[model samples]
Target: MTRIPHEMSGEPNPLRALTLDRLRSRTSMKWRAYPEDVLPLWVAEMDVPLAEPIVRSLTDALELGDTGYPAGTGYAEALAGFAEKRWGWEVAVERTAIVPDVMLGVVEMLKLVTGPGDPVVVNSPVYPPFYMFVEHMDREVVEAPLGADLRIDFDALDETFRRATTGGRRAAFLLCSPHNPTGTVHTADELAAVAALADRHGVRVVADEIHAPVTAGGVDFVPYLRLPGAENGLSLMSASKAWNLAGLKAALAIAGPAAAADLDRMPEEVSHGPSHLGIIAHSAALRYGTDWLDALLAGLDDNRRLLVDLLAEHLPVITHRPGEATYLAWLDCRALGLGDDPADVFLRRGRVALSSGIPFGTGGAGHVRLNLATSPELLTEGVRRMAAALD
Candidate 1:
């Protein structure tokens, strides 16, 4: 029951401040999915305490027996405030709808713009769920694999969009902003190019901006809706990733001016999927969790740099390009000769669990994603175990 110090009181690095013993005590998927012998760094969950404001808000709500169906526009308003302050982007609250979570929100947004069996394009080696949920909904997933540098491949994308929307058929482009696995934060120009292409091909853009707030090293995150050509685009956002509130399932589906009508068509029953408490917690984090988030970003930056040193020193064969956003590191293990799924080798031989890259679709092979949101000690140990697998 050790309390984490407030970031304002000068706790420099939250990642280093936490201990493995404390992290292992939690029952979250990141820890419980594997045995104690294996260091669990596979999932998106971070090893950090709840921001004090979020805890206090939820506690106060419970003490008052305030648990009921979500109401009002508090969550949307809070998000708007946070977006304006952090990214200098203004969110139109009237055009936002709350849904269960980012993935579910993406599904709902897709449904708004597409139909069953219609094509949905994604940048491959992206988030696995983007492929799963879209396919589960009976939509076709067209892969426009990223370029060698892991940024958008415009030529491929333009051609894919043409193929997807043939015969005047409608398609949706599922964009992962500040993308997952690789953590490439799309620049303003890149996003603008995507908007232009989506418009030209008559494809609706549905951006999964769940990782927006986690950008590090002074990178600017441009919301898709903020661009001029993105007037028809929709974006799904949540405080879950940045604030580690994944258990509390709530997210906002924001629509650009031209797409407001489509967003409004979302079934009203879909609103019930989000927990009232989740709304409160997410809202509190958006409104009052800025200081804690800043500290977390700083700590993640530290780990990002530390991972570079650790990989170079211990596992020189793995190629890691540190992304400007997200606490996940995409490691290229092709040189290790561990076959397509290196995570399997690492887990079976080295007893350390990491995410296998196969499920992430095209360009995922010979790669493994390591969660770097934990203490430096655990990260170092994880790399050491990964190296041991090669031996």
Candidate 2:
């Protein structure tokens, strides 16, 4: 494998804030899932400290006893500002509504666009929740597996879109930009092709862009709504993933120009789920957290290169296709000869926890997803444990 030179941003490593001792003391799912001796690298939660701006905002809100119900468009406006500044995308703040989080917002948008039992399209080896929540909503899922190159298979997507919209059913496509597990950032041309295909099939698109801000390694994240033929699509976004504010629970659902009326059809109850404190925290993140985010990105760049070197030296049999974005690394463990579910063996023998790939549906066997958003010391130890497990 060719080595890519590491890029430095000269900022302090924000990830250094969380030492292994500090992380183990927390009670989050990632830390609580395994025994004390096991190293947890399964979940998407970043092992980093909160951005100072977000901390300050939440503290100020609590000091004034301002824990009333969420109101107004603070979250939407903040997102609009961030979008324009970062992606050069013009977001219609007035056309956006606050929802509890990205998943709930996607479900609500799916309800607005497609009926029960209607077909929904997704790329396989996707985020696990894409399968769970869509089934819970009584929707039929059509899989368009990513190509051998680990990017969206346009040919497969075309075929799946046709099957999904068969008989003129009101189908919806759930798009994960800066895709999880693989971390493939979809390009503008690819998004435009998706727009054209959706237009042809008369299907509505709901993009889960929660990972937009964390795109690293010289890749640019293009918002789906910014495409030429994407005026009818809807986007679900939040600062939760990038800013490590998932527990706060705030997200936005923005509509394209032609879909503004459809957003109005969203039930009033949907807007009530977002927390007022969450809005303040998320708003502050978009408004003032860019420097911290940049520093985190620089640190993540270092981690990515470090993992490449570690795998080459310690676990040469396992191949990692470095993703253009996100901290997750998809490991092809087929060569390890550990059978289909290697994560189970690693957990028991290596005392290291990781996400099993089979749960991601078709084409997931013989793979594992490893989270790299930890201190360098912990990351080094985790890889060492996996190597020892093989021995």
The list of candidate 1 runs beyond 4 A from truth reads 1-12
Error of 2 at 308 (Å): 0.6
lDDT of 1: 0.91
lDDT of 2 by residue, 85-165 (tens): 788888888899999999999999999899999998988899999999999999988889999888999999988888887
TM-score of each: 0.97, 0.97
* lDDT values for all models: 0.91, 0.90
Please, what are the lDDT tens digits per residue for candidate 1 over residues 1-391? 1222223434356676668888888988988988889999899999888888999999999999999999889999999989988787889999999999999999999998999999999999989998889999999999999999999999999999999999999999999998998999999999999999998999999999999988876677889999999999999999999999999999999999999999999999999999999999999999998888888987888889999999999998789999989889999999988899999999999999999999999999999999999988888899898888878
RMSD of each: 3.6, 3.1
Cα error of candidate 1 at position 279, Å:
0.7
Pairs in steric clash, model 2 = none
- Candidate 2, run of 10 with poorest lDDT: 1-10
Model 1 TM-score relative to the real fold: 0.97
